[model samples]
Target: MTGTPLTTILIVDDEPQIRRFLRPSLAAQGYAVVEAASGEEALARAAEAKPDVIILDLGLPDLDGIEVIRRLREWTEMPIVVLSVRSREADKIAALDAGADDYVEKPFAMGELLARLRAALRHRLRQAGEAPIFRAGALAVDLVRREISLAGEPVKLSPKEYELLRLLVQHAGRVVTQRQLLKEVWGPAHVEDTQYLRVYIGQLRDKLGDDATKPHLIATEPGVGYRLLVELAGDAQR
Candidate 1:
């Protein structure tokens, strides 16, 4: 896959060995890799380099990766995947709640990491670009009008819920983190409020008649966040 025109990825880790191990492998897979050794540097490079995705290490010499994620969420919607030695679910949830799109434990498989990176990039692209109006079953979403309907009935949502649902619809097939959804809907100030997200998501699911257990439209990524798997057919023209 060398020179295959893959997206650029930034690797933020204090460990030289990690960067060394990742660079060649990522390059071999056709990604342009940039490295930053500290949170400060990562933030600066992210602004300047504008990497399509970020592989962030939670433990840094100068700052916590969560803080870095918080700061980055202020201005950018770029995908961030947390890489940490801490395998605890709480730690992973914390990162996910802090604007990380996904988390990977240390000593991870290179292929798995790369695959995750690709997914993140795909999600970002889907979110940023112009999305076609979508329909799945009786549900319909019009991107141009920012409207939604279910079973031939107009569904009303709060301003925040509408924005959140729009974002999920844009990224239809991909996972979106709580932090990303919060930032998009409530702004950066509310990124830490996971409960706010829970309530809004529940409201959305109820409106869509989505089953939490066997959800056909809205899918949850456990401790991560929610994704709306919009089925694009039939009612799109409406």
Candidate 2:
């Protein structure tokens, strides 16, 4: 009988060097690696391989990485993490907005990248199997009851605060952009009014007791958005 299959990760990049660097590193970590040199090939391999997660490079020889993300999102929700030399804030926002799960800038540390991969995988699993009660360490949100609790104690929040927290909880472990949050919470007219977000986020954070300096719950992504960090339900170590 065959043994358990390794979790597969598709590496899509135009540069041969990046692929060469990542393959062995990932394989050593017990991952089955798949490679694609261009956007078209990446799509083809994605369809054929049905890999668990994808690491995509934005500067592709054929299709742009954002477009590739759009196309793949059309068919599969397979987690896409963009590994790009493009460190511009706009590119990061565009990629995240287009459905990429995470972004890793060039000249990245292998340890950080590996941690991101694990986090992305965990995020995908969380999305696939959603629970009514969402837990991230000491934080917990009861989706069905519209309740908020931290460390087994009930937490009270205002309407706006609850909505903001609700949105964060809905997309736990993912970056929700300022534009997206502004639009959803305030409205199109208020999308440009970022002060509302600042005020509300502050209130929400305070109520949640999430420290701004060393945040445990909500993390600010600096000129991008916020990512609600997550942990195992029972504090299970990964």
Candidate 3:
């Protein structure tokens, strides 16, 4: 929100006061603002305006914010930061699991809100042009070479295992839905075969020495898909 100019931001909230409050502040930071008062409007404006980031309110008139996140994620990877009055930690987890990048409660500090927005945008941009080589802790994956190593020692993987790992690495920090993983890795015919995916994931974990109980490399989202918990070499956490 602070660094670059002309970065469009979509504000989705039913309340005028909240929109008014954020409008000038975001504009002052050199962001172009688009407003939507309902869930339907939010989706429409998102496709039309093509905003760089979205500040979404959970209690929209039409659709729930979680649904919006899921629908948008089907085609787009734009950053979404939920700004809502729901203070329950469960709501935050649900939003993130549904594909929201960040969450901010109402009556929040303007500075902190702006800071979160900036971080989300920065991370999205980093994922846009991901490096061929990815690293987390001591594990390294050379995506271009289709090779993997742990603590500088070579690790071999089967064809299916490598494919699954590659998909997770592509969307490192974000949750990848089980359906998306199934269709991409095993093709459309095997999308309903969740058990097949479970077997392969377990196999990949064993080869990578990743413990499912207290996972450090691959973390599962229960009913959702997996996320690579590794850090990209040059992309430090903001």
Which candidate comes out best when scored by lDDT?
Answer: 2
Q: Write the per-residue lDDT of candidate 1 for residues 52-133, one digit (tens) a residue.
A: 8999999999999999999999999899988889887678777877768777789999987876676566566656655567
- Candidate 2: which stretches are off by over 4 Å? 1-3, 231-238
Give the Cα lDDT of each candidate: 0.81, 0.85, 0.83
- What residue pairs are clashing in model 2? none
lDDT of the structure predicted as candidate 3 = 0.83
Check candidate 3 and list the clashing pairs. none
TM-score of every model? Answer: 0.62, 0.92, 0.64
Query: Which ranges in model 1 have alpha carbons more than 4 Å from their true place?
Result: 1-6, 134-238
Alpha-carbon error at 135 in model 3, in Å?
2.1
Name the candidate, 1 or 2, with the larger lDDT value. Answer: 2
lDDT of 3 by residue, 56-129 (tens): 99999899998999999988989999999997756776887688977778989999788667757766776876
Per-residue alpha-carbon lDDT of model 2 for 113-145, expressed as tens digits? 886777778777766767677777777788789
Model 1 lDDT-worst window of ten: 229-238
